[model samples]
Target: MNEAWQQALSRVPELLAAHVQISVSALALAMLICLPLAIWAARSPRVAAVTLTIASLIQTIPGLALLALFYPLLLGVSALIGGGISAFGFLPALLALTLYALLPILRNAVTGLTGVDPAAQEAADGLGMTGSQKLYYVEAPLAAPTIMAGIRTAAVWTIGAATLSTTVGQPSLGDLIFAGLQTQNWTLVLAGCLFSAALAISVDLLLGLIERGIRERRRIWAWAGLAMIAAGLLVATLPLMIARDNIVVIGAKGFSEQYILARLIGSRLEEAGYAVRYRDGLGSAVVYQALSEGDVDVYVDYSGTIWTNQMQRSDNLPKAEMLEAIAQWSSHSHGVKMLGALGFENTYAFAVRPEDARAKSLRTLDDLARVSSDFNFGTDVEFLERPEWQMVRDAYPIRFKNARSFSPTFMYPALVSGEVDVISAFSSDGRIAANGLVVLADPKGAVPSYEAILLLAPARAGDQKFVAAINPLIDAITVDNMREANYMVDREGDKKTPRQAARWLNEKLRE
Candidate 1:
């Protein structure tokens, strides 16, 4: 436990810096747009109503959904203009968070400006002051306190929402949170939450000081608050300013296997003298798109995922033919290189408790279908939406009494606790065996092959050193070794960090 906390703490500086950078940038951008708009809206009630309504509508959209929505929107725009815009990472996250911060700042600023004393405005007019002069000398100072209050609110909100940017591929404290949740590592989750909450609280306190300073007419207090914030931002940005070359950005989906593989890949790259960074917890579609766009240098993707999700193919082919077709399509269509399979499969398997399987005489999909109406199905959050699930439903007459979604980490526990009768388990997950669950046979072959495949970005496809560095991984990891590695991380007692598990797997490859 102490070691786990140490490992989790070691990562905090980099993640916290990234979290601060994005939060501050979004807040600053929100202020830039909102303050100007507020000045205009203060003069026109119609403008105020419309702008505020739009901001409110934006707020109504869930942060995660808003972040996810931008990927396709930006992709469409990029396609229309011949594809230069990146739909992943900082841009999408920035845009979503900026929009989120708008309402608080805009509403408060407008309220402050419009609510300025009428007598003061008259006095300025009587003094023959021009409109701009009145605003600059009189209205602005009086409105400063309220405007700062809005900024304080916006700062806290932006800091909180910025954590969601991890989904869009931006590195933030949320990476720790999301990865922890997936792996059930409470230490990591606690570390992420603690740092994020601390940063938000600190920023709010500083901004509150500025607000108070303005209200109390204390310039020293305001300057002191501003100085501290400047210092903090400088500290946060220093690491980013240092120039580093040949940095490889690895992308991974939200699961233990993906995390382990990413670290394994990173370890190999680092041995080859490349600086490494990871973008974990990417969605299935988003990770592939990111690689194709060169936002990610390399990552592992399943052959079946590329086939059904990317190729839009419904028909099943032999494993070799499917891999060949996927490779050809990826190289030709998107310039992505299908490096090779990792000699293992993590296909979705319908697993039930061994006792239940025996009691129901369920050994296959056909058997499961016979008793489906009495069972409750549990799946990873994405499985129900995946093409594989739809294909299974089409192939089988199975219809569960109820279905629920959970994080991959919780699905096995749900099965063990009898909260769920069955789950869409990964064939390579160790917990399936650990819990002695039985995976129903798919005699119909409706589910496509899901051999784990490494993919390279277009730019790296021709790089011999890059290719050679990763080539050893092809056909290296057996399913047994992978399950062992995953179990090392996923197991409740004496859990290994993904990096440690990767190291253990790498040693197995050597043997």
Candidate 2:
């Protein structure tokens, strides 16, 4: 627990900078976007009704779903624009958060502006003031407190929700929370929650001071509030502004194991004197594309994933031959270099709770095939769509009574808790042993070998020093070692951060 806090605290500066950058930027933009519409709507009730309705509709979309939806939508835009936009990271996160921040600000702005005293406006008109002048000098000043209240509410909401940015490759305090949740480290989660709450409370107080100053005509409080806001913004954005140019950007897919491996590789690179950074939570296809396009310098990917998903090959080559083919195909096709396998296979395997498997005598896919309709099948969202699943089904003629897809995080618990009777389990996942699940054998070789292979971008292919730094890890992490490292993070009540687990793996390798 102390170690988890140490790890979480160490990342505070970086994560806090990212969190503020996203939240502040989103709130600022949302204010800019919504305020004008709101002011205009204040003049036109019909327009206000329509615009408010739209903003309310946007707020109804679940936060995580909104963030996920941006990826495919931006990917399409990038395709149309000949590929300049990134589908992940700050852009999508900022855009999604900005949309979420809109309704409150817009609603309050409309209410504040419309609620302004009509007699005040008449007095301003009597002074021969133009419509814009009356709005600026009379209505705006009178309505400042109410509008500022909305902005305050928005600032707090944006800061709290900004934590979700981690899901789309944007780093934030949520990174700690997500890592903690995945690893089951309550200390880390608590730290993130506590810190984020503090930030919200602090910002709300400061903004409240500013609002009170405006309402009461207190110049001292107004100036002090403004100064604090400026100082905060400067502190928040400074780290991002002075970013290093030579950092090696590593990529990882959206999962706990991927997060651990990326951190492990990144820590190793850092020790080797390379400046390292991670662009994690990438979609599988995006990571590969990012690697090929030089957006990412390195990442670990499975040989079978490349062979089938990327290479579009269906033939079941022998393990050695498959690795060779994957290496050759990647190098020739995408300018990707296969460094070497990491000595473990995390292939897709059918798993059932031990008691259920024993009761059914489900020792192999063949056994499951005979009574396929007796159980419900569960799998990660992507598995059912993958070619490997099609191959498995064709080979075994197995079909469960029902099949449901879940996020990787939920799939195992779903299977173990009897929500589903069988699951497509990652063969090397630590959870299999932790939960005491039995993996059914695939004697017919339906699933291909899934060597955890290291890959390099084309430009780095000839950098032997860089290659050598990572090459020693090839074939160093045995299945047991990998599983144990993963378990160190996944096991309940004794979890380690990814870096801690990675460091343990390094120590084992040295021994």
Candidate 3:
């Protein structure tokens, strides 16, 4: 196997532990709540109808949407309660997964309880059993098989949906999948998928065996299956129990470059004798929010992203001026410290294949304007919604044949394949040079320079060691180094895992 695949496999134990914890925790919590509610509902027709309807309603919300919605919901609750609950990570993921798990378990439990034989209840009552005794001795055993089936179904659903937690800053197998998909690394994606599938299948089979055992009045299979689950939970949560202090949390946005940078930062912190954990693949806005809220310790963000998106500025300032403005604004407004630029700019640039640029004799935005009608434009999803694009459009008389948005991962492939004639590309992206694309110059200076900058969370701003430790990296990474690191992971034939790429970059930085 290749180094990339080997790296991918190395992560399975850690990722699987996370995935299992998330899945089992959510399923276990759901069962605890749903089973009792199911019992109560089985005894009362009105309660059963109301509870089932609510659970079914929760199930109808798309899993991703449900997960995203929890951020603001908990944010508000946190404020109202004077701050305790975290709006991101395990809490929200758990809540969303538990909600998703509820319908299946609740419905199945209700079905099982309600379907209990009337004759059996009468027989239990004739034997001098009270209501609770009848339920324990007669109804529960009769209902065990069906209830277990519901739990099995819910377990599968919980495990599958738990992967989405990666988007909300909780690490799981989905980290591998999301990072892989972004970098077009299928090995990581496939590994994550296979691991998650195998886990679900294994859990389902064990639960199925337990269900069959209960129905046949065989205690051994049921006890053995339950023991396996308990052991897995213990194994999954052991890391969390041991590592509880002196850890730095690093955040990264969803892309190859961010992943590489996060790993670089993590390795540096680890080498400094600090335990480092990452919350990778956070949304651009979400990462900043997490940092400011102290949910994450540090991350790299571009100047222009903070300038226009976070700061809401529209002026096209020079790089130094913009960087200074962002530093001051962030410090004053959000208590976040913009340590310094990373000595590289990853700005928005319009790029075309070299062949297309040469055929059109295009060298600048002005040249593009003359032939704009012939080319279709492509951009990552945020560009169209960003003020930078509006500035560029208003500055030039350029009108493309069509414009479409793609995820960052797909944007370059789309451009290279002729799906789009021009792409609003990130200047530092490795694929731009790797694929031989020419970025058009903007003589009019319509776009802002996106110099990569390091940001510190409010809680860590005063930590002298933390700040000092990261200072060396501020001006260390150049555009060339970044692009090369990105290309190592993103290029089709030559692949390096993010950690390996980070190690390579660290070697260069030391020199």
Best by lDDT: 1
lDDT per residue for candidate 2 within 1-511, as digits (tens), equals 4666777787787788889989988999999999899889999999999999999999999988898888789989998999889886888899999999999999999999999988987898899999899889988888889999999999998999888888777888887777666666678788889888988998999999999999999979978998998898788668778868777888877666777788888888887889887765667766787687677889999988988888898879899999999898889987899998888899998998899778878899999998888889999888989999989988998978999998766888998889999899988888898899999999999898899999998888888778878887888888887888888877766667788888888777631
Q: CA lDDT, every prediction?
A: 0.92, 0.86, 0.88
Residue-level lDDT of model 3, residues 1-511, one tens digit each, is 8776797898787778888888888998999999989989999999999999999999899999999999889889999999888887889899999999999899989999999999988889899998889889888889999999999999999999999999888889998888889878888899999999998888898898899889898999899988987787788667667756878999998888888999998988887888888777898867887888888999999998998889888888988898889999999988999889888899898999999888889999999999989989998877888898889988999988999999877889999999999999989889999889999999999998889999999988998888877788878887899899989988878678788888898877732
Pairs that collide in candidate 1 are none
lDDT of 1 at 366: 93
Ten-residue segment with the worst summed lDDT in candidate 1? 237-246
Sort by lDDT, best first: 1, 3, 2
What value of lDDT does candidate 2 attain over all alpha carbons?
Answer: 0.86
Model 3 lDDT at residue 297 = 94
CA shift of 441, model 2, Å: 1.7
All candidates: TM-score: 0.98, 0.90, 0.92
Over 4 Å off, model 3: 124-133, 366-373, 397-399
Name the better of 2 and 3 by lDDT.
3
Q: What TM-score would candidate 3 get against the native?
A: 0.92
What would the TM-score be for candidate 2 when compared with the true structure?
0.90
